[model samples]
Target: MPTEVLHRLSTLSLTSVKQLGRLPRLSSSLPALPAPRPTLAASEVPTLFREPHILSGYRPAGQPWSSYLLSTFQWHNESMNVWTHLLAAPLLLLRCWSLLEGAGGPWRLLGDVAALPLVLYVVSALTYLACSVAAHLLQSRSELTHYSVFFLDYVGVAVYQYGCALGHYFYGSEPRWRDDILGGLMGAVYLPSAALLAWMSCACCCFAKAHYRRPYPPRRKVVQLIPTGLAYVLDISPVAHRLLVAGDWQRDDDGALGFHAAQVVFFMMAAMFFSYPFPECCLPGHCDIIGHAHQLFHFFLALCTVCQLEALFRDFLARRAAILDVHGGELVVGAGVSFFVLVLCCLATAVWMRRTVQKRLKDQQA
Candidate 1:
């Protein structure tokens, strides 16, 4: 009887050990607890949502980086803003690659004096759009992140403008000025303009309280328009000179002038939407999800960019022989050096702005 009891006890102990082993496996197979969503403050989101009827899907500040990134898959106010440019960046890059690889009129002319600057312009556009994507995506993470991302976005715009000016200097017209003079003039005009835009963007992000209070305050609109106006002036001056002074309008392709006109129109529309915040201002909450002015602004800006590229390509095709024959190696080198220097300055400014934001945050916390 005692032996039988001991044997039974041993069997029971063995079964208990097996059950314990199975318990861990069961636990391992169980789903993990979902991470908590960040709690957002009212001010963290766009001011338009301040109206009770408008639902602002505001993500909380101080979210984990992984959480913010994962938020891309979720629906929010910024979802369209983030995805529009994010998806467009790759498409634009593919288009650029196709243009570079295809053998044809403008593609063949790519080896000419304007090739490098044109390439730079394409790269700058990609960079600007990519930065916009990043800024919109991660701006919700924290105030520091918001300020830093905005500064970077501004820098991206400045870089693209610099490239635009470089391309215009190199290829927009027949080389009337000496290569050195052209290079010097471009650097003088665009470098200061770029610097000013960057500074203004940083100031807008850092010190412009009106931006947070409303979408389109007159003061804020003026501040924003200043950069866009400066960019237009810089970009269009060469086109005007080509048409008016160089008499290149006669050689333009059938649709080139129309495309240029469309480009200007689109840019103006973007500015108007950006500055006025129309339709949404009128309808308020009704258009919150689908049809906001800022979204329209983005779409128009993209169209403007496409038109600009088309115009540039048309000009390139028309002036291929002259561009190839021109000996402007020194001008090309100067533009390249200036581009690098501008990029470095932008980086330094971004870092400085980031530090300033961080320090301010720390002070507030203290």
Candidate 2:
């Protein structure tokens, strides 16, 4: 009876070990059963989204259309920046057309002789508008798109300035000594303006490109050529002395281009007040809305335009005085004073902009 009892006890121990081995299989099956397909955590959504429903399982990723739509609908910083200058285009066109209509006869047929300048202005404006639009809409899509468009926009502004200066050199003419003086003043105003425009284009293009694109590398050597090209083009003033005297070029004033190019560098230092701190000082959110560095720069440019116009008018008086009789000397003096003030103001603006930029940088660092 004792032997039978011991054998039965051993059989029960074997059964217990078998059940323990099976217990692991049951536990393993629990994980294999797919532990409740994890629902997305709240943290999984983008930080920009205030609500999950707004996200609706959408992420921008590589989607071009999504970025385009967001540019319009989203309350982004660039929204107003794109539109303000866009509205300026039609207004510019209307003004140009009206000026042409009023000129009459040969001037009307030539489309206001000023039309070439206007065309350059309109084209630059339109290109800038397109760039702003693209930057806002497509910049988010990829790094490559952003840098390219930004570079192009800078180029457009330079091209606009070049065209404006050329126009002044061509048209601000009169047949008197005072007219010659006035023409010289007008030429001074525009010549510097053109150079500054070119420098800005080249500087911004080289800087922005080098800094912005990292994942996608552009050929540095090719980009270096852009500034070189800008220098050559801007320095090469469209004016020839012979063109003014005989209505054509006998020997192009290649030297004049380099001379004017130097003047542009000086003006750029003065205008640096406007763009140096850039969006940080003016362009940021405030510039994006209404009063920014670009707008201020445009305002200064318009002032230059007015100064040139006054000089042109004085030249006309001087020329007419040579033909008829008018006080040309006094008019020339007044125009000179006005031009001096404009230059001083531009310098002041540059200084102010520099201080403002420094403050912002300090704040940012802090």
Candidate 3:
């Protein structure tokens, strides 16, 4: 057979070794391989790895007091909310310092004359700090926590208002407790009245929590106290009016508060302004926006600060004009503390109002 024909026949027959087979040339082609991966050892793994399910990690409820306090700085809704008021405590301390330094020489002699007002200020600051932190942290924890913290917040407010009244009483000549006939009787009514309101609010909150097995609403008590506190604040206007009758100046056993009815009246009005829980009056969602009841309360509180300052200035001037000699430093300190507190309360009110409004609006849209 011809060579080509033989080659074809051999290739086709699968017997090409003799007729058509030839050695093959090899190329660089090879099988693919995977890249090497790094391995992790049990010891090399982080402690967090042992608990794989704890991606977020469950934090126990009974966190330490210091931990809870430090937690305010972390990523929580109340982080900013909590610190805002906590900052006020230090600011008040600073005010106390400034007040001491600014007070004239004659004022320093009275030992702890400011004890009541100062104590009130401290309690108010502490109560607010606790309320702010507790409300911020616990309100979201559980239903019980929510109600407890909320009641505490109201109690803080009541204490703050009562402190304002107490501060004013310090400037007056009458002892908070005088058993001298009309003086004693007045003290009996006024002092106990304020105390009773505070106690009732606290009691109601406690009773509601314990007996009702629910969050007690302090709204009714607040409603009752609003008018009563306002009346008490207004009733003191007679004193202010009496001061006015004595001309633009009058002297008390201690010093002189400005006798101008305008100034005194302004101060009295501020107290009345703070007496009401304006936060409750807001039409649910509306005030939650830019002008909530809390904000209004803050504004009134701020106004009280300004008014008190004005009253203080008037008092100082009157004292200067009268050439009277008495230490009024405590009163000044009390006022300064109140002013700082007023600013803090105002800021809190603003923030809360913003949150409330945002929440309401989102709810509506949803």
Model 1, position 345: C-alpha lDDT score? 76
Give the number of the best model, judged by TM-score: 1
Clashing pairs in 3: 258-315
Candidate 2 residue-wise lDDT at 101: 57
Q: What ranking of all candidate models by TM-score puts the best one first? A: 1, 3, 2
Per-model TM against the reference: 0.75, 0.41, 0.44
**Model 1 Cα shift for residue 13 (angstroms):** 71
TM-score of candidate 1 versus the correct structure, residues matched by position? 0.75
Q: Taking the tens digit of each residue's C-alpha lDDT, what string does model 3 give over 1-366?
A: 124333422342343222212211111132111113111222333331211111221222433345444444343223334444444445445444554456553255345444445345445645655675576555543334444566566556556545544544444323323344365575335444544554444444343433332122456446545544554453343334336343424344322343223334444444554454344353433332233333333333333333343333333333332221232654446444654454354345434444554464468579
Cα error, candidate 3, residue 194 (Å): 2.8
* Superposed model 1: Cα runs more than 4 Å off: 1-55, 104-113, 174-217, 242-249, 324-327
Angstrom error at residue 56, model 1: 1.5
**On lDDT, who's better, 1 or 3?**
1
lDDT of each: 0.62, 0.39, 0.41
